[model samples]
Target: MLTYRQTPPIPALGGIVARFSQRRCREAQRHVPAFDLPARLDRFIEFYLGEPVRVGTGAESPRAVPEVVLVAPHTRPGKRLQMLGDVDTFTIHFEPTGPHRLFGLPLQGLADHALAAPDALGTAVLRLRDRLARAPDFDARVACATAWLGERLAAARPADGLDALVAARITPGMGPAAATDNGRVALWARQLGWSERHLHRRFIERTGLPPSLHGRLLRFQSLMQAHARAPASPLTQLALEAGYFDQSHCIRDCRAFTGQPPGAFLAAWPDLGRP
Candidate 1:
């Protein structure tokens, strides 16, 4: 049997973490189908305690999954991953600027890439992984990971000036106005007394995508989330509610992000739309 669970972060860590999640398969399996992870704006740090899975982009040969990996926001369509044998993994889903703030890594270079934890985060992660493997249950592992993250959070460099302002405004659950406005970058630059170019560069350094592209992904994610909440709703209605100009516009975004129309894409993997 396979089970997946998502748990919210503690109240104090809420700003840095979106959630903690676990995926486990209790028995070994001969064949497991690959799944598509649709493009999104959040970053993740995943820990694998069992067999390594395989991951790849479209049409490319999948590679063995790392024991611990740090994934940046996927600006491209998304990647494919398949689990074999028994699977057990835990993941930390970070806010848009969480990784940058916590690790002081420039996100632009990491965009669309998944790096081994040791390379991206150093040997300390290996120790954490060892602790996680030694834990008796999923909750124990979550506690271990949370404690490690808390230590990092305490030592993390504080965001300043534009970074602090942008981080405050653009979070994982930011509203549609900040996410759907096409001219938000220019408006923010003016409001913050910075040049548009400066704002664009700083935003990419912090979130791994330009403001416009990030907004587009946010809008697409909003539509998918709405569909997950109201599966019976018509695409047109969801599109309008998600800030798309029309159903056709939503279809174009679906095609761009998932390589299929909304009906076919969502029909193929109904639950993938949920966070």
Candidate 2:
């Protein structure tokens, strides 16, 4: 059986960390599909125990994913992740601006990619990984990860004030404003007292994608999440609710982002293989 649990981050790190999730599967052999959807507005820091977690499949079969990976916001689909064999992992899902806050670095390199955390973020995470492997139980592992993040959070440099505010406001589920004139980058720039060009640069540096692309992705992600919640809802209604002008626009965007139509995407949601 698969053991899964999500716990809230410590209060001190709440702004940066949305939540912490742990998943363990002890069945000798298993396949867990990590779907490639729209550009995530957030970042994920993962720690894997037991076999290393793998990404793509070889000509013959798949392999284990890396021990630690920092997944940055991606605007398109990546190779599907098939976790083969027993696995254990705890993940930190951070807010859109969380990675920059946690790592104190430009996120351009990490965007649309998952790389070895130690290579990208350095040895601090590796040390934490070792402690996680040594911890006796779930609670201990959580404690270790939290303490490690706390120290880093303290030393990490802050994001540009305007950039942080803009990112925090560009959250998911912002309604029609997101897809129409209300979602324009210039509008936000004016409101934040930043030149449009300056805002664009800051966004790319801190969040990987510019404001325009990020807003579009957020709209698509809203539709996806709503569809996931109510699979039976009419596509037209879901489209409008997610800020698409109509069902066709929604369908087009869905195919563009997921490489599948809406119905097929939802139907294949339960299976990780393909749509």
Candidate 3:
């Protein structure tokens, strides 16, 4: 049996932490299918308590994942992950700016990379991992994670104006004014009293991708999310509703992000559309 649950962070930690999730698989002989992890806007810190997963890109052989891993915001497609044996995982999903503010890690260098948490965040993470492993239940694990993140939050630098702007305004699809991409970028720059170039540089520095590209990935994510919500919906309808110009546009993005066209990709991984 596979069980999964998600818990929102305490009100105080809402800005930095998105949520905490736990997934466990109890059947050792069960065949767990490999899935393509799509590029995401948020970042993650995952702790494995049971068998490590195997992750690989393209034709390369999958590698065993570390016990603790930090997954940065991916610009392109992500690695395929396959689980083996029994699995237990606790993950911290961070806001786009959360990891940079809390850990002082530059998003620029972390993009498209999954680093061992202990190596990136040092021994403190290992200590927290030990505590999580010993946690009595999911609630206890959340408490442990909350306490550790709270301590970090105390000394962490607050997000700057750009971070706040991106978090608040630069989301999937176009902004409220319904302007072209360049126009929206210009408007955002004016709000911050920055030139367009400065905005681009700062956005890349903070989020590991240009704002335009980030918006594209977010739009792609929205299409997948919509498909997940209504698997029976036609692709053209989903595409138009997700802010794509047309089905062809959506197809192009699907290929770019998942290396397959919409129908083939969804058919091959039917579970992706499951809620």
How do the predictions measure up, each by TM-score?
0.89, 0.85, 0.90
Model 1 is weakest, by summed lDDT over 10 consecutive residues, at 266-275
Model 1, runs deviating above 4 Å? 27-32, 159-182, 270-273
Minimum summed lDDT over a 10-residue window in model 3 is located at 171-180
Best by lDDT: 3
lDDT (Cα, tens digit) per residue for candidate 3, span 1-275: 67788889998786688889998886533645887766666689999999888899778878898899998877667688788888899999987778878888788877888899998899899899999999999999999999999988787877677777777653554432232278878988999999999988888777788877777776676787778877789999888777777788789888887878888776666341122
Candidate 2 deviant stretches above 4 angstroms: 28-39, 57-61, 159-164, 170-173, 176-183, 271-275
| Candidate 2: residue pairs that collide | 53-64, 53-65, 53-66, 54-64, 54-65
Model 2, 51-150: lDDT tens per residue? 6655652233445667898888777654555554677887888777777777776887666778788888888888888898898887888788889889
Q: In candidate 2, residue 258 scores what lDDT? A: 71
Clash list (residue pairs), candidate 1: none
TM-score of the candidate numbered 3?
Answer: 0.90
